[model samples]
Every structure is written in C-alpha cells, then in structure tokens.
Target: MSAPIQMVLFDAGGTLLGTNTDHPRWYEQFFVEACAEQGVEVTPHQVDEALVEAAREINLTHRSSSDEQVRFFWEHMYTWCFRRLLPNRDAHQLACHYIDRFEVGEYVQLFDDALEALELVRCAGLRSGIVSNFGSYLHVFLDKTGITEFFEFVIVSANEGCEKPHPEIFDLAVARAGVPAGQILFVGDNLREDYQAAERHGMFSVLVDRYDLHADKPALRRVKRLSDIAQYLPQ
Candidate 1:
C-alpha cells in the first residue's frame, strides 16, 4: 500500500497565489499597457510574442536567482520586449519606468481558496511548506499575504541556486520536508515542473487546474481549486 501523506508542499505563484489582474494573459496585458504609456501602440499578441522571445533569451543567457539578480533578469527581459515593440525608443529607460510602477498588492494576490486549503492541511495533522521557483523576496510576499505562518519553510529558487524540473531543487525541498518523498504530497500548477518532477522524485503529485486548462488529460490527478485538496488527505 502507498504511504499516507505526512506533508504537503505547494508551488506558490499559481497554486496558492496568482497575479492580481484577472486577465488570462496578464504578462502580455501589462506590457501592452506599458507600451501605450510610452506612446507606442501594440497589440496583446505582439506583446506576447515579445515576452516569449524575451523569456527564451533570458533563460538561455542570463538566469539568476538572487533578489537583485531576479530584478535584473526581469529588467533585461522587459528591455528585450520593449526593444522589439518600440524599435526607436530607449529600451532600458522604458523597462525601468515600467518596473518602477509595480506595487506588491497590484502585482500579486492570495487565491480565494488558499487559506481554507492551508487550514485543511493543518486540521488534517499534516505539515505544510512551500517549494517554489521564486526570488528571494518570496518570503516577504508570503508574509504580506498573511500566509507565511502556515508554512514550516519556504524554499525559493533564488536562495537555492536551482529551479524546478531539476533534481537539485526537489532534493532540497525533500530534505527540508523531513520525510520520505513518498510521504509528501506535492501540489502545483505546472505540469512538468511540479507534477512530473515530484512524481519522479517519488512524491505523490497533484496538479492545480484553476482554469480547467488540462481537461483533455483525464488520466492526471488534478483539482480545480485548492479547497479540493481535502479529498486527497488521509480520511
């Protein structure tokens, strides 16, 4: 028989929290608006294209995990996107202007179901923690959202020098979880990063499908909201 889950580790951004805006393409929407603020008109599709290329460029050449490094990474990403969208404009200046406009509350929000889910974990006598591919500021973000106390630890990519789909990061999380991988339940929104990686590491995995995006994959275990996590807990 499978071991009963003793701990629950979550992915932060999409699982427990989300972008403040309701737009499905929040990243592209923000950049499209950013372009308009600079007197350039660009479609969301255009911004999405630029953003994708920028992400690829940054990932291949300039990946970093520290607080400052993370900031620098985004700045460069924005700069790349701006350069593509506004050929005649100063990309660095535009990037900095948009970056300065970010306010924590305006950028992120705790999901409606997150609190009840965490409480469920607590009431189940299961330990909870976070394993996320986030910057060093993630702890502060969690604190600002008032959910920091729920987690025993928050392992961030910036602090650990590795990110998900990579064994090293999962190793750190499993070590900190203080249980055999099979005794942990890993929940996250990403397929490869959270679900497949955790499964490969021997942890039970559940995918969070807030948008019902993966209905075609009927064989995968998933929940539409975090509150549904209770069904997976030991009864």
Candidate 2:
C-alpha cells in the first residue's frame, strides 16, 4: 500500500561491514598474541573491560566536538584501553600499532550477503548510500572490500557533527538523495537507532536480526541477511 522505494540506504559496520567486535577470538586472541611477544599473559576479560570503559569515556566526550579531529581523539581512546592492562607497557606505541593495522584492513570482515544485496539495489534501479555512526575513512574499507562503487555517498557522524536518533542527520540524508522520505527503505542492525529511528522519520525500515535480537517485537519487519531484503523492495 506504499509507493515503491526509489532509494536504499544502509548502515555500515554491523550491516554490511563487520569486524571482530562480535567474534570473541579476535579480542582474546589479539591481546594474547600481542602480549605474548612481550612475555606477558593477559586474559580476554581484562582487555574487554578496559575497552568497555574506554569506549564509554569516548562516547561521553564525543558529545563535545563534531569536528574532523578524529585521529587524535581515537588515539587517546586506544591508549586509554591499552594503559589499563599494560600500565608499565608502551600504551601509546601499542595503540599506534593497532590503529595502523586497522588502516590496512587487518581484521576487516565483510558479510556474505552484503554484495548481493547491494547489487540488488542497483539492478532494481534504486540509488544507494550509506548512513553510518562510523567516523571518516570508511571509504578506505569500502574501497578495499570492492563496494565503494555501490554507494553515492557516505555520511559519517564524526563529519556531520551528529549521529542517528538525531532526526537532522536522517533529514540531511533524504535531502541529499533527492528522494522523498516515504519512498526510501533503510536497513540496519540496531533496533532503536536503525529501525525505530528510520520509521519515526517516515521511511520504510527493516531490521537485520542476525541473532534474533528483536524477536519479541512482533510488529517489526526483520530479515536474517542482506539477501533477504528482496521481499521489502518496492514493488
């Protein structure tokens, strides 16, 4: 009963591009390997705790600035986490190594359904873009993964000075696409940030419930993979 969507916007990170954040070994193994080289043994719990606190602090501080000074800020966050477990170790040096690895796609993981879904958007004659809470330089990962050509633009919260749940960012995305809000479909992983937020703004929203995270929300539309998006495309 709704118009066919003219555009499809996707969230980065968990939706199309995923990393070791969900994979436990990436966390435990990474620290174990790195620390082993220095003759130290650290548990995954210790590293995870430090990272949780560091991320919390960064989230709090993120409210103050929306400028392009992301590198310096992230460096501090990385150092903060590293220092908690490696007090006598070179936290700054360790942080730099980790960040450097990220630059070259050290642990970057692309979902299986990502490419097919993106291609489906193109073949369906719908324009596409990415709306992400991620920082800048996502283009690098996009390029390395061979998906950069699929998107018309990438809106980053760091550059935009605001993130999702803030209507202005979605408003700006719709405006940039030159499409009416009602004629766009947004797909992502978060229940509140991606699904509810997009729905609130008049767009058709679908949640990617890889883990059945929102099964209790009976009224919501859910897809297990990006390839499953075909059912929701405007007919």
Candidate 3:
C-alpha cells in the first residue's frame, strides 16, 4: 500500500560493484612501483600488511567518526605504508600516487544484472542516483566503469562533509534530485546506513541483502537481486 517509487538511489561499493579478495594486492603493487621510482626496495607483501592494518584501524574508528577523521586515518596509514617501503621518499607524495593507482585498479566487477536493472528503472520513468560514503575520487571510478551517465546525481560523503546513517546526507540527495522524500526509494547493502536513514526522511527503502543475513528485519523490504526492484513498482 506504499506510494510508488519515482526515484532510486544506490550505494556504490558492495551494492553496485563487488571486489575480489585480492583487491588490496593492487595497492601493494602500487606501493612497490612507487618505491621503485625512488630507488627503494620493498616487497608487495610488506606493503599489503601495512595497508591492511591501516584500513582495519580506519574502519574501527569510522564506526562512530566523521568523514574527515576517517580520511585522516586512511591518509596516515597510507603514509605509514609508504614510509615502510621507501625510507628516502616523501610519504605524502607516495601516498597520493598509491591512492591514485588504487582508485583506478582496485575495483571488482559490477554485478551482471546491474545495468539491466538500472535500464528497467529508467524505462519505467524512475530517476536514479548514487549516494555513497566514499572518498573524493569516486567520480573517477564511476566514469571508468561507464555507469556514471546513468545516474542523474552522485553524492559522496567525502565531498559533503558527512557520512551515511546521518539524515543530512540523505536529505542532501533528496534535495538535489528535486524530489520529495516520500517519492524516493533508496537501495543499499547496509540496513542501518541506507534503509533506516531514508526511512527517517519519509522515503521508501529496500535493503539488498545478498548474504541473507538479516532476513528477519520486518520493517524493511529485502531484495537479493537488483531486478527484484521491478516488483515494487506501480502496476
């Protein structure tokens, strides 16, 4: 008995794109290459360990931290990883290089049904956008994947000075799309961050529970495939 969906906002990482288990290896390789540029010797495994530890700490702090704080933690870790690899090089510059490479090379393939589902949404006259808690370079990743044009709006928390689970972030996306909260439908992999926040703003929400982990949550609708969204549309 809910209102029909007119707008669909998506999450970037786990929802739209999947990453391989070896994803961090790209960062390790980049660190090795950057160190080689400085005439330093380092192994990919060493850089991998440093980056992993740093990422773990960042995620730990990010659970209740601001986007800037999370960025600082990531940058610090990248700096430390670079320092470990190149004793004589500038950590900040090397971190920048490694980040650039990681952004370009570290993504997993998009789900096979993503594009078809998006097209169906468009064909049904529903607008689409992306709201992600990612770094500033997310646009580059979207463009590289050729899915950027399909989205009418892209909101990254790093650019907005806020992160998900914050009502303000969802409000910003709703405002940008020029749609009322009641008409928007947000789809994401996280139950709390995407669904609960959108619900707070009077928006409909669908949780992409690919792992079947919280199947018992009664307040929200759970979908295993992007194409399942069509069932929720107006007849």
Which of the numbered candidates is closest to the native, going by highest lDDT?
1
lDDT of 2 by residue, 1-235 (tens): 2877998999987799877555524555566566776688888888788777887776553441253446676687678877887789899999889878876777677888899999888888889999987666677788888998899988887778878878988998999889889998999988888999999999999999887777898898999888899888755
Error of 3 at 122 (Å): 0.7
* TM-score against truth, every candidate: 0.89, 0.83, 0.71
Candidate 3 lDDT by residue in tens digits, 120-177: 8888888899999887677877876679888998998877877788877877988898
Q: Rate the local accuracy (lDDT) of all candidates.
A: 0.85, 0.81, 0.75
Instruction: Estimate the TM-score for candidate 3.
Output: 0.71
| Candidate 3 local Cα displacement, residue 24, angstroms | 16
* Model 1, span 1-235: residue lDDT tens: 1999999999998899876666666778888877787788899989888888887775532253556676788788889999999999989988877665553444778889999999999999999999987777677679878999999989988888888888888899889988999999999999998999999999999999988889999999999999898999987
TM-score of predicted structure 2: 0.83
Q: Model 2 Cα displacement at 92 (Å)?
A: 2.4
Q: Candidate 2 local accuracy as lDDT? A: 0.81
